[model samples]
Target: MDDIKRKYVIPGDVITTGPYRAEENVNLVGDKIIATTVGISEIYDSGVRVIPLTGMYVPRIDDFIIGIVKSHTSLSWELDMRSCYPGILPAQDVFGRDFNPKVDELTSRLKKGDLVAARIANFDRSRDPLITIGDRDLGKIEEGELVKISPSKVPRLIGKRGSMIQTIENATKALITIGQNGYIVVSCEEPEGLLKALDAIRMIDEQAHVPNLTEKIQEMLGSNSE
Candidate 1:
């Protein structure tokens, strides 16, 4: 409810009170909420989330992400979601409506080397991640340059309320789509602006923790303009 979240926290730290909703890698014991991960404690409008400074992608339900569709058979579609384990986009999950996988061309839905914007529907340690694209925001992604960075750096790439990504888009005159899994797609007409945007993203990924990152990014953009 309140944006009054503790910016930085470590394991065993009390991030908030028990009355608040607790996210994954966090525990609500008694009247206090405790952190189980070493990362920044962020309380959003909906709930609280701890962005781990270092860790592999742990698929969570409703996490909007982009993945490269690697393979698919009659039963399942596999995706490379920048995690050690490949995610599974089940036919049942994507075709719960009138659509039938058997009747449709598989490649039309997803193919090898194709990028898709989807959401994690289910995840279990022993099983592969299950994803879905029923939502409007989730679908096949095309015509954008892909940029991969550390999964931990995703939040920094998207500043508070999307200020950071917007800054890059405005300066480069490009449309950038950022996934929570650290996959970014930047589409620009001008090669010069595209390179500048890539450089800015790399800079953000490298120096995310430093203060004045926004100002520094502005400086870089200004120099390019001049």
Candidate 2:
């Protein structure tokens, strides 16, 4: 069987399953075999495997991410979410109001450079990611210094049922708003407090996989204060 399989092996890859000495120009299809043109060869009975040589980012639905507000218009604001395209947050989607309001009021409501907590509402082939701030918790983020991180790391920062956020708040005595797109806004009573909060947030993002991290952070902050 191995010899027969080798006959169909392609030139780029050596036959892993067969040394059949069969005819050339044969192509192996739907078999538990793999061939590599590379010099290395090892015989194994397992199935064919191909490793990916490149990295790719594929966006999906319901991916909580952080984004930066890049521009604003009468109807919506544009956000740079580190994706292939920028996202849009329409005024109606934000306020849940059907009618358009005066330009001044809308501008005052959401200005550029203001970090917003939002979710991916939709996406079309021609348009960018549509974000919505319709939920109660989703909307204008207030009183927090925005810190950016990878969108993939947002789940770690939030933890299970917001445990990580609560831990940071308890430790540094600061308010924190973590946006779905990766925007983190932190506010504290003092500059020192803000710094400590930022450090704690970074630590949480790094150490969130560990169990009992909240307690560990609390202890660390307590020791530093004393």
Candidate 3:
């Protein structure tokens, strides 16, 4: 079904007038679905929502994120996850349960300016979010070009059932690590392929609300989706 429709909207703009359920960044006022933020408004079957063009990422438990090591103390490393609060990776999580602040320096493993792939372990309004890199897939990012896009556009970039990402990967041979927080790391063995992949990602960031985006990206990559 061609149930998806999108358009730019501003605060208080009437996104639609119907029985559509108001979702994120939108409010239902009587029969109208009103935009509660400046962004692209989406109308799908039975639902209406606004994908904000500007906003901070809100960390959620188990959300995979890309973070830049900002600083470290004796026992913990602070990372910038492009969110309101810094992500804290405790020494124990990285250095094992027997970690000692005196003998195990945080910088020994992760220094400032280093990038990492991690998951949000826990968070609450009262404190900074805690992150963990204990999982094999979660750890220091050794290489790749880091790219940032609005967090709201992440879903569109991923597309339905990982189709968009798979399309890009298959065509360009680029390994893309997508962060739920919108920080992406893309790498490829061939320089031309890398460039193409990066361009496709930028295209998505700029035009996520536009329809037929997967087709557009496929054209940009000069290949068909597998």
Candidate 4:
């Protein structure tokens, strides 16, 4: 954990000799806990966990995200989620309405260029990442301007209990939806509002690790408002 804390660690790096509660992105080899994936470890009194700094979005259970439909097969749709591999959005995972490839045109319901907001249903190493859009909040996005940022900065952009995002929303009066995989959508009637929200998101992504990030964003917004 010491080596992992100060510097970067690669896969198979021995994380701990003692019994450790293995957290995200790690594996166990013999009696030692090893890093299965590349990430940094944060050791707390209770346990040690990995925080990935760089890598594509590895879909985990229940991760809400936005994806662009790339192609669709007879059974499912392939989505580009900024990952090494595309995610699968099965017809069964669609909201109350289901499209049938046998009879109807799948592209009509969800075209190749359409943007969807969904959640990671399952992600097996052997299988393509599965996503579900059954929830009320999950569905097709008709209109919005999109932006991309580093996924690692998502938690910070959201802030404590969603304070950071709320600030940007209130200030800009734009409807903003964030995807854990780094895609963000902002919709507003006024073009100025959309630009402001995009600017705020840029600031958050670039300066998330800095101290008083929320305050800095607030001041920036204040001056811009003036």
Candidate 5:
């Protein structure tokens, strides 16, 4: 099967299957199984299926994320995540208690101008991503510098089950938090470590197809140190 036929079909591409039938395939990109003819047909072209370029953020449930706290009420906090709509993180969701604390107490816990790591709890028909901090691991970020990238680039940064993040952490001695919306938070004791972490992330964003990226990063760091 050709990559285009197997993965996705672009506009103006000719696909045929039915007896003496030819149809121009339109722009369709995804994991959807497209039928070329009434009966299943084999793909003629083979290549990597690439999604068309677009500027949009599609929110998913339970995605680990980072956002800045914009405003806070007695119950919830508003966050600015550079999306079509702002996200909301409620106090009960984060604190796990119904007892409303004083303004100062709440500030001490999670205040305005603070960066937090949370999870997507739900979304309304408007597609506004609602965040939560009910879990132990999902809560206020203790430390880190927030970095932003295109939401589409998250898959490349995460790699497989944190393999990429762990590799960078080990090499540069920096802690990293990757958000589904393409926000990165890096933390390290030394400025040099933070710089190394930033450089490694930029490299991954630029060259995602390269295998063994962790090893390549190590080599680059070693040469620079010398």
Candidate 6:
């Protein structure tokens, strides 16, 4: 509940104690809340959770994610969510509510191997996560270079106050779309700038835990005379 400082921690490290609720990747032991993974720990309001350093992507409701269409049935399409469970996008989500499977051909919109920007509409342990791309910002991605990174490192890529991502964008003039599931799409007018931006992103993913990373990224971007 207090303003606990954030810190890097491994499994068994005590994040804090008190009446804080254990959120994720943390365990409640006696009066101490201990981490259950190697990651950064933080306390907010009355909850304590660990942002894991490495792990599979876990779909959470309302999470905006980029998914690859893997397959489809007559009723819905299955997407690779980069998790154990596939994302289900129902036919009605893409078509109107009056959609008829027999009349509305599924492949008329999206087919396998297509990339889509979607949001998790529903999820639980018992059922696969459901995703929807009906919103204004959600749909098939037609252009941009795809880049992947560890899902856990997404927050680090975003940085405090968007400093890290802003740096890369300003330096390279590249547009980057980040997915909570670790999928990224980058677009730039200049080919050289595109490569530079990707290199910077990869650097961040590999060395996120390294201190003074903001400064290091600045240096890397500035080193290019082009």
Each prediction's RMSD over C-alphas, in Å, is 4.3, 10.9, 2.8, 3.7, 6.9, 2.3
Cα lDDT of all candidates, in order?
Answer: 0.84, 0.63, 0.90, 0.83, 0.68, 0.93
Clashes of each: 0, 17, 0, 0, 4, 0
Model 2 clashes, total count: 17
Better of 4 and 6 by TM-score: 6
* Candidate closer to the true structure by TM-score (higher is better), 2 or 6: 6
Clashing residue pairs in candidate 1 are none
Q: Model 2: how far is 205 from its true place, Å?
A: 4.5
Q: Estimate each model's TM-score.
A: 0.76, 0.61, 0.88, 0.83, 0.71, 0.90
Pick the winner on lDDT between candidates 2 and 3. Answer: 3
Which tens-of-lDDT digit does each residue in 3-60 have in candidate 3?
Answer: 6998989999998898888899998888988998999888888999988988889899
Candidate 2 residue runs with Cα over 4 Å from true position: 1-60, 63-66, 94-106, 124-126, 205-219
Compose the digit string of candidate 6's lDDT tens values, residues 1-226: 3577689899999999799999999999998999999998988888899989898999999999999999999999999979989999998999979999889999999999999999999999999999999898899998899899999999889998898999999999999999999999999999999999999999999998899999999999999834
Greater-lDDT candidate between 3 and 4? 3
- Residue range with the least summed lDDT across 10 consecutive positions in model 6: 1-10
Which regions of candidate 1 are displaced past 4 Å? 1-51, 92-105
Report the error of model 6 at residue 216, Å. Answer: 1.5
Error of 1 at 178 (Å): 0.9
User: By TM-score, who's the top model here?
Assistant: 6
Error of 1 at 145 (Å): 0.7
Against the hidden true structure, what lDDT does model 5 obtain? Answer: 0.68
Better of 1 and 3 by TM-score: 3
Clashing pairs in 3: none
Candidate 6, superposed: residue stretches over 4 Å from native: 1-3, 14-20, 43-47
lDDT per residue as tens, model 5, 1-226: 2233433334333333323222222223343333322221234443222332233455668877788898887777898776777888877776666556564345657778788888888987766678988877777787888887766667767777877777788878888888887788999998998998898888877665567876787787766557
TM-score order, best first, reads 6, 3, 4, 1, 5, 2
